[model samples]
Target: MGAIYTLGNAAANRLSLLLLTLISAEVLDVDSFGVFSLFLMSVASIASISAFGGAATINSVVSKFYMRSKDLASSVLTMSMLMSVFVSLFLSALFSPAIYDIANASGAYEFVFIYFLLFILSLLMAVFSSLEGAVYALKMAKGLLAFSLLGLLLSVASSYFLGAIYGVYGAIASIFIHRLYIALSAGRLAIGKTGLHVSVGSVKRNKEFALMAFRRLSFPIAAASVLAAPAVTLALYILGKREGVASVAEFSIVYQCFVVAIFPAGAIGQYLIAKSKGVLSEAVNVRVQAAKYLFVYGVVAFLGFWVAAIIASHYFHGKYEISISSFLLMGGAASIYCINCSYSSFWSSLGYAWPIFYSQIFMAGSILLCSLTLGETSLEIGFLLGSVSQIGVNIVLLRLTVHEKVAL
Candidate 1:
């Protein structure tokens, strides 16, 4: 799941960065950029809450019931479906105001205010996530990868072409369709042969499981601040408030490369959940497989991204520019986080929810303070530093959970 998602994510992020960079320069004026920037920030932030952040727990529990209980898939599916609908409604409400404000600030068309409805994309994602959980439950990582890649392609092609044709509004249209495609395709599959279903009683019963799952995931989710929120905050800090939006947009594009890196490893972690419990029993095969994949992720990431960055810098021109140091450091930091994320899954498998859940302190600070502290003169440094705390927290948590010999 991680590898495939990473590839798809990389392609999409690169495309988005390229497209947005151009739009930031040629399409959006400074005020427009500010408005667009706010929308960008809200998309990530609201989606997290909107989804109710339940996918991982869904992943863990669904995996357990599917592989072990077999009879529980329908119940898990049912719970997922219900949660998806609830999350969408909740997130749509949360994001609507932000969209309105951003659009009002942009002073574009009145329809720009309607951009807040994009939260529907997030809500719809909750639905897709439920379906994804069903896929995860079935250990259908490859199928999930295909489903994700399809949506990614749709998003990439549509957004790029649409943005070029209709500016940000066109981009918005692409987003609407993207959500629809993902929800329909993945949702149908899970509900089809698998009979993935959800219910209210199951939601009540699984609340504890869900909470623990959230507790375990807080580190990773918070760690992600380095990519979007902190990056935006740091840009605003360093670049003078005037340049904040543009700088945020720029580094966001660059940092997305790191986010893309997580996909493949993430896919692997998702696949491993079914047998994750087997690790504690000194399952040599599982441990060995984990070790082998970790090494593979590292080697591929190191080699692949370095080359891509070089090409992006030398050939892409204007838009993809990054200083040599920033590029390398960013990639290295991303690589570190990737490995940590993989181990965090192992910790999760151990029933410990890895990174020892210490990231709570770091996540908040990283966003508000660490990012805010970066002066425009130090934007790159800020991007590199913010994720460090997340990486550190995960490392410690993984150590606490995994057997040393496990090579996590």
Candidate 2:
């Protein structure tokens, strides 16, 4: 039942973003849409860095202490938020120059400040994500779904209206507003509803514990996230350089659809992580159940993609027509990627971060290598190859790590 609500929350979240993508595509020119896509990709990467795996760590900690100590959970949340502030400032300073250069190169220099604003907003979104993890740990998925639905409605309405009037800036402002709403809502639910008290004094006292939590648990996952989150951003950067911004727009559209298709796998993976409780046996069960869900969902999602492709191509009047071959290749990649995620989540639950790190290394390396070698004409091939490489690494690592203890 918790899983069901989590899935619904995932669906609503993805649907909201998809609708915004379509709206942006409809309102903005192809090149502008490409820039918007780049902004979003940057946000994802920045959010991961700013989060520093605090979201997942909070989930694990809060779950472990939920029955034991609410004060500890509250303290962890406060610590994570403090970490977010420092990380976000450091990241903004570190990446701002590079972002400006990218904007100048892409002929979107005027929008650079908006891009920076969005980058800061990503950190706020990260904080929201941590709160959401706490909510999940508390089995408050129903509340999450309700808040997400409300946020979805607000975001869509705001994005559409603002996008039509102010172009990319307005669209981004909508995202800013939406993130604020979600962060506030999640904080309320995690702290207010749960009756968890967080304070500066609590954070001060737990400073050592916070450092230990980050060192022992969050650091490795953060490393893995730092690698994984940049995959799409790097791909887009390469594609924009190799092809043109318009091609980047087209690729972003397909990738957004791909993301929507794979939402179920991600939702399930996160739910498993929240529920697995660091037990290898339970993690194995999670992996198996995830496989079953993915197998059924993958088929339906691919078929849905095909129909969507046809309709989207017609609606856009060939402005964004996706080829059948591209659909098949990307669908295959999405499926393989789902498998990797399911397995990776198993390791994540067990607190074995090296496997996740290795998987990201293989996956990101394959994608970047293929993108550099294959050129724009075969970009989808890069996704396919990357997914294949990731699954291969995941299987080998899983077997080597757990072979003696678990029967395959």
Candidate 3:
């Protein structure tokens, strides 16, 4: 039941994003759409930094400790949110110059302010993401689904109307509004239901323990996330530099399909993480089952996407041309990524973060190397190679770590 609700919420969230992407593609010119895609990718990467694995850590901690001590869990949540504010602001400031250069290079100097706003919003979203993780840990997936659906409806409506009126800026503004609405709603549900309170005093009091938890449990995952999340951003950056923004726009469409394929497995992985109860042996079978399901789903999703691409190509008539071969490559990448998510989540549940970290390193390294060399012709192929490297590392690490009795 929890898994079902989680899957639904994931579906709604991804659908909203996809709709926004499609709307943006339609409303904006190819260059503008490419810039928009770059902004979105940059936010994803920066949000991972702002989160610093805090969401995963909070989910694991809240699941383990909320049953034992609500006060401790509340403290962790409070401290995590407070930490997110500082991290987000700091990273955004630190990266501003680079962001400007990228904007200028991409012929989006006028939209730099919007990019900055989104960057900050992405960090703030990290805070609420941690809260959402807590909500999941508390087994409130049904509520999450409701929130996701509401957010999706509102986001799509606003993005479509505003995007039509105001082009890329309107689309970006709609994203900001949508994220803010979801964040506030999630925060209310999490705090009101859990009776969690956060005050400055509580944050100060819990600082040591919270930092300790973050260092021990969250740092490696954070490292891994930071490494892994930016692969797409790096690819887009390379594309913008080498092949220009039009290629970025085209690749972003294919990437959205890849995201659609992976979201279900990611949702299942989140459910596994929340429900694993910090037990490796207990989760092994569940993880295997999840991998099996993902394998089947991946095959279907890939074929379905291939068919859809064919139809879309015919209908759009080169207005937004996506190479069928590129779509197939991304489909393959998404398949491997789905399988990897299950194993990565299993490792995370047992507090074994290094394996995930190493895998991300390989994944990022592969993407970086490939993007620099092969991205001129096809961004999808670079991503596909990276996905292959990621899964290979994940499989090796999973086999080695499955027998270990890791303490959480």
Number of the top-ranking candidate, with lDDT as the measure? 3
- By lDDT, the candidates rank as 3, 2, 1
Per-candidate TM-score against the hidden true structure: 0.75, 0.92, 0.92
What's model 3's lDDT at 301? Answer: 77
**lDDT by candidate, in order shown:** 0.54, 0.76, 0.77
Clash pairs, candidate 3, are: none
Candidate 2 Cα errors over 4 Å, as ranges: 94-112
What's the count of clashing pairs in each model shown?
19, 0, 0
Stretches of candidate 3 exceeding 4 Å from the true structure: 94-112, 375-377, 402-408
> In model 1, what is the error at residue 305, expressed in angstroms?
3.8
* Superposed Cα deviation of residue 322, candidate 3 (Å): 1.3
Please estimate how well model 1 matches the true structure, expressed as its whole-model Cα lDDT: 0.54
Q: What tens digits encode model 1's per-residue C-alpha lDDT throughout 1-408?
A: 444543453344335434444444344444454445555555555455444434555666666666455345455555545555565555455545544643454455553445445556656655665566566556555554566566666666776677667766675667667767766876666666764555556546666654555565533443343234434533343443545344654555455565566555655565565556435653334545765676677667766667766766765466434566656666665665555555555655654543424553454455445445544325445444545676677656546545484454
Predicted candidate 3 versus true structure: per-residue lDDT over 1-408, tens digit per residue: 998998898888788888788778888888888877887777767777778777777788889888777777888888777767777766665445544555564455644665477566786578767877787888887997898899999988998899889977788888888888878887887888676766666657777777777876678887887787777687677778787778888888878878877887887887888888778666776787778888888888778678858865875565776778887888888888887887778877887777778888877877777787764435677667777888888777666655354322
